[model samples]
Target: MVTGVEMRQIDRYTIEEIGLTEELLMENAGQAFVNHIISLLDKKKARIAVLIGVGNNGGDGFVISRSLLEKGYHVDVWLVPPVSKVKGTARYHMDIYLKLGYQVNSFETISATGLSQIFMSYTHIIDALLGTGYNGPLRSPYREIIEEVNRSHGNILSVDIPSGLSADGNVDEPILAVKATHTITFQCPKLSSFLFPFREYLGELTIVDIGIPKRAIDQISSERFIWTEEDIIQTLPVRKPSSHKGSHGKGLIIAGSQAMTGAPILTAKACHRLGAGLVTLATPETAHQAIASQLIEATFHLCPSENGEIATLNLSNEVLDNRYDAIAVGPGLGRSTKGDFIDTLLTSFNKPLIIDADGLYYLKNFLPSLQMRKGVTVLTPHVGEFAYLMNEPIEKIEKNRFQFSKQFAEKYGVYLVLKGPYTIVTTPRGKQFINTTGNASLAKGGSGDVLTGMVLALIMQQRDVQSAISNAVFLHGKAADYLTRNGWSPISVIASDLVTIMPHVLEQYQYS
Candidate 1:
């Protein structure tokens, strides 16, 4: 079930399918908008300017102006086109404002000096000029007004999306979008707001409750998702006091070579910290000492190798029969070990698997076997790794991350976590969860390895595939967010730091 906040995206359908008039939706949207502004400003003496266009967006501006006037605030309404050109709900609202002894002016009639005088007088600028319907490039008077607003230096607020930004995706050479201090977007956040490049245009976003019916949203299907803390808390695995270490589950991590033993060590440590009862690391025989010395909590399995890399080994029934909750491979595990150890593991293991880095590289070579696995599998691939697995160019993956992530999950019938600025979690069931925590400090090396460990740990703790992936991704990023706030640099936030902070981060969800 979605929260009432998520249902606001259905307002459009409520107007069209459910027989509710657009005018009523508009009034509710406008009143909600006014309420948010009042909560921010709260009786502070300030002059407000409302910049509106000709469509329903302008209609919302008109309603806001009427509501503000009723509240006894000094307000000026500037319509892009003449008042006569306004139509539908916009025209109706304009008529109401005119009858209420309020003045509405056209941009054309105001001279350059007059526009400057108007711009300098307002403390808060309301940009009701564009809504989600905007497509392609911005044009003419709207473009000029957007440029003026960009230069105004006044605090600006956008209605749905910042004007000039594409509602569906990023636009090349986008005209100056409104630099909103805060954006009161109706319903769901647009796809563009989650992507890079254009995400900067949307300021601190606030989704206002506009009374859109829930049935309308349930009828629609979308792969995009936004995850909240409650969502994570609900999915957490229940732990019993009677449970022992073996009952919780055992996870085997095959990672780290000679020069990169730290990667696997980080992954194993994170898994143990996240409550994986028994954690083991399979590494090149030469690196066993380093991993064993550092991570006393995890057992080490020495694997045969040449030059600090593990060679492909035959998987005996003895190895496969041993109970393991899950298996994770490929963080700093070199590509040239033997004739595909990753392929050997995939064909042999029938347990839950978490694949990252070199493991993802090996999977790219044998993607057909991805569907053949008899057990649950989660693939955590960064953009480049994802590109290799999908056989698509990196540029193409970056441009359409949401589509590619969803496609890969459905194609392989496994959970996929496409890690980046906003990590996207896609499940075989077609549900998508977008994680919003984490900052630039997570851009350092070994961070991905830490994330891999956390996911495997959750799986060992008996969390479902979706819950394991979602909660792990959220906490992994949130750990970095906490460290970043404490002034930890990207370079200084090593893998061990993430493990140290896990308990504090997990505590935040206990009450939920």
Candidate 2:
């Protein structure tokens, strides 16, 4: 996935370097979009409204309208701007469309009632009013047009991206963006398509090649990546026939307080469910009895407690030893006064360390320690926790999820998993892999805890740290998706339900 800016650069490189003309590229993009959406269109009954702006996006719409008319489909090309404003390649295509004996409807003087009547009358509305480069608040007729477009029940297909939505994934006024039933983007998927709130606006997204040179795409180092099913399939860990229980890996989970003991149980169970050969739980001795009964597979290291929360970790003992392959901390371990527990784990643990929940809360105090760590540190934080760590408001973090995540990951030399709708996993080197396997069903209190355990288990098992982290995240969401698809309601699927159904989800890839 490339950012909007990166996509524009590629467009320039394709035209100048590869010698593909702007008109030819627009023609190809239009054809590709038509081919993708043709099945959904009925030549006899489909009344199409191709909304056109005075940009390259409108140029593509002109081609799409001409192509649709040629195919015997009834189409009306509406110019959102005046005829005098349309220039360059967009105007060039408009001339051809008009020469084909097709009429263009100009929205220059159309009233609100007239606009709604036109939009509501159409069976499918193609949003070509704005392109990926368009950002910030919508202005004048565009804003007014979009508000009516949302009210229309017509199946909307946005070209490149929904009008008014920022391709950079920033939402200043998201409510003004067009609500498309489908978005056929050119070259590659835009970054905004994967983000929340905006994802709702862009429905059933498709990426069309538009004949852009592979070299042009390669010229820009698109740090953003998405892991497909094939990637997960190939990366799935294979257990050897002669392998014993120890062959998989051992994981240590330090979580839980007397008040919130279920977090550790959920974490340990998820760790074991994801195929951790040996699982150990380190928590307050007071909480052990509660966590132990629920998660029997894990061995316990009862830590000293102060008022139900773990006060400190006895690092001198074997609890933080070499026998464990990974350690996951901070699911339910509440606020600690000293903050040394997190510091000790960061410094003492030479192996991979996964921190989540309250662990992230404490780690906020030791942000600099992440850079100094000799071992790999993985931080899994939702927007709220991430905001806490960054000491910024949630609004700022939500708007610039990519920028903030990339900065933190690169600066600290740690793998960062910023969890939400489409979970983004970033490496220390600044490469980000956006996960698309899950749905809203995964939204729950313990979902993040389940993810922490999965990350802990997978990192120990998979040789490549990147694959391990991405796979765990993908699978964690996939499990929730599976449950919701079968019979479970989104609200009914709890954290433990995710752990329960994970085997069935993993088995598909494992045995396939």
Candidate 3:
């Protein structure tokens, strides 16, 4: 989970509101840094070489030197520029170190060759050369030093962020970023830590609490979110002991055509396995036998269509009156034939709707009308489908997925699930949930059908749209996680295999 920080605002508070007194914050930050280092290393064997710059980050290195010295560990401080150039809290800490009889190496005293030789002796390197305040490309002594640090075999622990990468935007150039084994960041994790390119530079991240007041955090409002297990667990629906098949609620799956019966079968089977008391698969009459044979537990509702194609469907008033907790449409339902079928279903169905695949095609054509539905609607779309629905290119959607999802949800007043590596769920109320589960194993065919089924089942079980989406996404990713651990390829695990694994995954999360 990442907690993003606004660097400019934080710097402003530290400099202005905090009264420029480095003694308090620097002391806390340095002590926290020492605590982490102590936890990683043994006192008898720990030997650390600290790299210091002219800024506050360098001051942190100076303070860390004092802390390690007091603990009886061999510590060496290398100040990059001349000690006279160091100012502010950094110079203050350097003077204190010198007064306390600790040796501080100056850039002028040591030649490049001498510095290289000194760097070879340390087991671990502490990177305080540049902090989050650095912008643009590197220059001069710092650039040269970073190159040497990268070449060194010692493990580097970057302070806050890895030095050369931008804290906010895209960094273009072959800048040398610290290859830290662990980064001890203060307060919240930076946005760049989660974004790509820069994310590669940030190894394993550990956000350390530096006692920033909660009131200060509250003042900084951000729309981004990272979902955890605890965040979704409480939202799952609790089943009653007396719950019967009908009590769990019914889900209507209107999917598949003549040659595409497998899509609805996969969806209906998953819905049944996910604890939907009753699942009814509504497809063309010609495909009824195939769906029924595969989904033995689910009831079949045969709708009239043209020549085994889903060109049109006659859903009468009586069928609409029958209570269904949720309805899922589209999944291998052919685009050419099922376009009208989709339009009719959207206009007539007043239940919770799960729209995916071919249904998205029809919805895209008549989005304004579909958006006016009174019932709660969930649109599940991969990048291509999402782009088509929004009348934009795929690249635009991928670049600004979070913003696009949020805007789409707000525009339609419905829940939008932008499916991909990081599946984003956005609600009409402006809340966003970024899913962290699932892997490359889930990037196979029919996975979306299985997800639609699971989400529909959860919604039918009386869970809120948000809860249903979160639980469905988590469970889907968890299933992939299981396959990954068991050494099963995603291509080998069919949609039915996902249904069989659902019980075990749910049991792992079940409380006594």
Candidate topping TM-score:
2
Better of 2 and 3 by TM-score: 2
Question: Candidate 2, which ten residues in sequence have the lowest lDDT sum?
Answer: 313-322
State the RMSD for candidate 2.
1.8
- TM-scores of the candidates in the order shown: 0.94, 0.96, 0.84
On lDDT, the leading prediction is 2
Point out the worst 10-residue segment of candidate 3 by lDDT. Answer: 1-10
Superposed on all Cα atoms, the candidates' RMSDs to the truth, in angstroms, are 2.7, 1.8, 3.8
**Candidate 1: segments with Cα more than 4 A from true spot:** 1-9, 42-44, 111-117, 313-318, 487-492
Tens digit per residue, CA lDDT, model 2, 68-154? 999999999899888889899999999998887899988987999999998989999999999988877888899889999999999
Candidate numbers, best TM-score first, in rank order: 2, 1, 3
Q: Score residue 364 of candidate 1 by CA lDDT.
A: 77
**Between candidates 1 and 2, the lDDT winner:** 2
lDDT by residue (1-512, candidate 3, tens digit) is 22323654654566576554556677777878888868887677767888888787888888888989988988888788787788988888888888999997766666678768777788888998888778777887888777777777787888888777666535654547776777887776666665455666777777777766544454553555667688666767778898788888788888888878788887987888778998888888888887777778888777776666565556674576486767898887876653765666667777888999988987877777677877788999999999998889987666567678888898888899989777888888768877878877777778899999999998877546787788898888888888767888766776667777888788767662
Q: Which pairs of residues collide in candidate 3?
A: none
